[model samples]
Target: MAFGRRRFLAVLSTTAAVLGLASPSAERAAAATVCPLALSVSAQVSPPGGSPYTVCSGVVPSFDGTPLDVDVSLPQDSSGPLPLMVMLNGWGHDKTDFESTTPAGNGANTYHWNNAWFTGKGFAVLNFTSRGFHRSCGKDPATGYTYATDPACAGRADWTHLADRRWEVHDTQFLAGLLVDAGVAAPDKVVTTGDSYGGGQSWLLALSQDKVMTPDGTSVPWTSPKGVPLHLAAAVPQYAWTDLAQALIDNGRGSDGLSGAPGDGPHEDPVGVAKESYLDGLYALGTEYGQYAADDPTADIPGWHARITAGEPYGKDPLINQIVRQLADYRSPYDMPVPPASVRIPVLSIQGTTDPLFPAVHTAQMVNRLQAAAPGYPVWTFYGDLGHSYADNPHQVWAAANDEANDWLDAVLAGSQPTTARTTLSTTACMPGQTNATLTADRFSRLANGSWTFTGSTGAVTTSSIPDGTEAAAVDPIANSGCRTTPAQSDRGVASWVFDPPSPGIITGSPVVHVTATPQGADAELAARLFDIDPASGTQTLITRSVYRVTGSPGNVQPLAFELWPAGWQLQSGHRLRLELTQSDAPTWRPDNETSSLTLSPPVLTVPVRTS
Candidate 1:
């Protein structure tokens, strides 16, 4: 049954009273009669053995008049002004990602749960095709994905701004406002969420509080067309990035040291090493499944990919530095202003410990900032083995992560304290029948009670050959981007060290590595990998890893300190801890390509450990 504006509102009011639910006020009902944007109801779908819900799909003009295809699903059995859940899609994906019933792989499918599932929970879910993707005034001829020509988007080719707060983020706020004005969503009870790309957007929305940037770059309070104020009650950003620049191309600069904790130094002026595999994969997906702004330097996917992968003179190139600065300033939540305590939205951030694209450290950094800026704000983080990479226990972790997020959302909406811990870290169990255990703490740093350090030194290693191992292949951005294990191999151009723990323990935080190195060339790059080596068979399970890039005068010795991606790994008694440093971790990170060598003094490895 197709319900027009008046019929929908009438049904809502009548059903609400019949069901003894709160009915919309007469003022709200009257205001619903006049919607600012023209909305057309296409179909009313009823899931098998479930209540019917209306699905409305149409083009909505964004901040700059860019037409965005939006889908709104509302439960027919529910009353008006229901809690709103604005679901977003990942990069190169469309609104259908959340609407479709197909399960997303990689143990990160919670965000892909269909719209009906949420509407069944009394949530008015809104999904939209982000700017520059299919149905959002862009077309990919290869995939035959094209939308009906809308005059408003006549000259708007390749308009994706890469989730710029002023663009894609504003689009979501604008659409939510319309729903509020139409009495379809509760103005104060809205939540934003999504995975990967959408996760990043959700984070920015939470940081935005109730403010939005106008098309002209002016910041203003978020309000509906009818003047109803809008605010996000909560945000769940799964496997998201706080800093797009650091995520895609990372400089080793980590968060400022947590009080009394050893942290990486301040952000120095340096262009980071590009994650070639992910960058290539994303660029291809954008061009194939969506649209890319090839000519627009700021939004040009191809240009950015080429410049990043070109390699060398990294910190010296002004254009590359400009690109990094622009990405961080325009696309990173790290640069956004934290909301004051009065308006700070509760955030439940779920990240993957082994996700090479955006690791647990990303969320940890954001959490630290939030804690410092808005003390005691309701921000919880859950890290597991999931996301764009492979997981050792996909089903178990996926279910657990989803449960945590759901409970968090429920608690925040009910204005009750969440029973869940402030931080939860789940380790990837590598052995058969091994329990994938969890560790909880009040803060990220507190996850590890103490640490174990191994001191060592190695001969000169050169970036002449690709590292040999399954770990490298498994973590490759394109080939086998997931967690995997194989027999540990000590090969040429690889610096290796092994440590035998006297007792069973858990490595629970980011591993810090400090090396004094003398470069053979103008620049040097290193990929560090930590593994769990089976005592008997020597089988190795990849725990976590990171890539570091640096430029210096040849033969000049400099102290290099960096942290690997944060992880939670249980080490059995008698099992060994192995650390390997190589020149290239191909397909995961772009190889430095130059035949440069590094002469390093004894390196120090500090691992945060907890023994119960």
Candidate 2:
């Protein structure tokens, strides 16, 4: 039932085995051994029950000689040869995991939705699993998580490196070429898409200019698992990260509107928050020169990049830090080292507003670079108020149209016109009782607050367990890192909003807080936190928290301001919705230091709820 290069794995192996080609002396010796495996391809049914798709699975070469299992799904009813696509997964994940979760629910993979939307109109999808993260076999011999997790082998990682995006870009190019060789797909029509790690891979594939070197000595090139030049056509990454190095640096200390809470008071441990606080500077570079050379060692201000030179920093870093530098350069379809003066294909992208990993600056910078390289690349950005996760976010909005986001792929990739809206929405907090049982059990608890009091299925879902080390890093507002812990004053002095326990379980998404303050022009800060607001110990232990800042400047007269961000967690049955309004958050935002005293009114942070 499968078509495309993925099928070639089966066809070639079968032919080889049938002809006794397993080994030159197999027939003259013992016996040819073939591993028994089940590989099948399927599709989404529309209008309650639509056409079934044909798909196939097989173990193929990943970034290395070691094989990776892939499931290539295609439309059975297409009238012509199909377009090609390679889908990837994120961190601590595998291929099947991608198939199970997405921005869209219903067990339909969002990437799969791309397949459905495009395949039904005539496109082909090849889902790839890299070496270590998922079921994909093999290993990353070089940098990134691999090096840190296995440092002794750090410098040795060459073609096997999965930390940099080139390894993945090669994975897509090789897989696409194989599909073309099989005659099931057109090599030139292949496109790539993914989220988080996958999404970052998407951009890496798109901007991959060539096999370049870095000052740090990391390696990247269009090579086979054996080091060969690979190719591609288009790409789309969602909620991705770029300039993570800069992010680590700037997030260390915040500036003006941008802040990264490193840790708590001077005595606080920098362990979890240290390197990450520098994202502000990283994002600043992304905002200012994301399209340029922030990571390039040759750049004037190599620490962070902004504007113009940001359009493409291809060759600059190849001579210095190869690992960190190589992480910056990726080869696109054009076979060039930069995004190219133009792209032969259109590109589409999505980003979450409250994504904890990367900044919105990355998305904005990407569009600028794409436009500079090629006019009308046909880009799309979807905003969500969630952190790095794709599965569940308390801030997720239930959009009837968001469910149909794949239609864009259908229209552009397979040539189908899907009628769906592509806009951002706020999470809708669940009411006291209803059918869609707001409580999503597993993913419900780990958010703004460290944990929530729950009932019913106490242990039905594992993700519902508490995340250790949950405390806001203390911030020195003066030093300008806006990240901080919830002050006792904020609990009693600031305006507070509360909700009662629900009879039925509940799940909350991103929150939108609206606050009214007296004495206009106040620097109002709204923080949506999930805590035992009425703490049994009298002191509320802070959990995961979301904070935002706004300068009230409406006609020099401040009205109620609405600040939206992700609660990105769940509100268990007994947990209540807590919204606090105050002058500042320690390190994440600027403190309101105005002489005018501000009072909080109508301070309620709305929770997003979806019921059955």
Q: Which candidate is the best by lDDT?
A: 1
Best candidate per TM-score, number? 1
Task: Please report, as a residue range, the 10-residue window in candidate 1 with the lowest summed lDDT.
Answer: 1-10
> Which residue pairs in candidate 1 collide?
390-482
Q: Tell how far residue 476 is off in model 2, in angstroms.
A: 19
Q: Give stretches of model 2 more than 4 Å off.
A: 1-48, 62-64, 77-80, 100-121, 138-160, 209-233, 246-326, 329-341, 368-377, 386-404, 414-612
Candidate 2 is scored at a TM of: 0.48
- Candidate 2's displacement at residue 34, Å, is 16
Q: Residue 442, candidate 1: how far off, in angstroms?
A: 1.3
Candidate 2, after superposition: displacement of residue 17 in Å? Answer: 26
Where is model 1 more than 4 Å wrong at Cα? 1-51, 100-108, 111-114, 140-143, 147-152, 255-261, 264-268, 457-471
lDDT of 2 by residue, 331-367 (tens): 2121223354433344555554434445444554445
